[model samples]
Target: AQTVTQSQPEMSVQEAETVTLSCTYDTSESDYYLFWYKQPPSRQMILVIRQEAYKQQNATENRFSVNFQKAAKSFSLKISDSQLGDAAMYFCAYRSPGGTASKLTFGTGTRLQVTL
Candidate 1:
């Protein structure tokens, strides 16, 4: 069984600044994937970034990057030059590489409040 944990329930960031959201997980499997999904008030889950367990280098997408510490089982998301549009509920998720019933295990979620 795998589980994701977001220690911070809520976080706030100023526009044009940067913020790092912390996340940790527990899993027995070595092969899997970690992800960060941003869901605005609209409730649409947007894939922010993903990192494979075997990849030594972290994953990055534009202003979004991940600090993936495989040994520590910690995967955190860093948002650069935060914008008002970035305000949303961020969720950390995990998915096994292969399984008969593959499913994404998500964290409790962190509400991101963006201020000017």
Candidate 2:
């Protein structure tokens, strides 16, 4: 069984600053996919970034990036130049690459608060 964990329940960062949200997962499968999803007050889960387990390079998208430590089963999200719009609940998720019916296992989200 695979499980994702987010130790931080909430986080705060000043505008234009940076923040890192920690996440870790336990999985026996060698091939899988990790993802970061953001849910704003609207409650819509939007994909932030994704990393393939077989890839060594960390995934990056604009101001969002991830530090994926495969050996440690850690996948942390880094938001650079954080903005007020970035305030949301961030969730780390995992999925097996095996079947089309595979479901995503998500972590307890970390709520991000951006201050001026």
RMSD of each: 0.7, 0.8
Query: What RMSD does model 2 have?
Result: 0.8
In lDDT terms, how accurate is model 1?
0.96
Give the TM-score of each candidate.
0.97, 0.97
The TM-score of predicted model 1 comes to: 0.97
Q: How many pairs collide in each candidate, listed in order?
A: 0, 0
After TM-score superposition, the amount by which residue 108's alpha carbon in candidate 2 deviates from its true location, in angstroms, is: 0.7
lDDT tens digits by residue: candidate 1, 1-116: 89999999999999999999999999989989999999999999999999999999999999999999998999999999999999999999999997674689999999999999
Stretches of candidate 2 exceeding 4 Å from the true structure: none
In model 2, where is the ten-residue run with the lowest total lDDT? 94-103
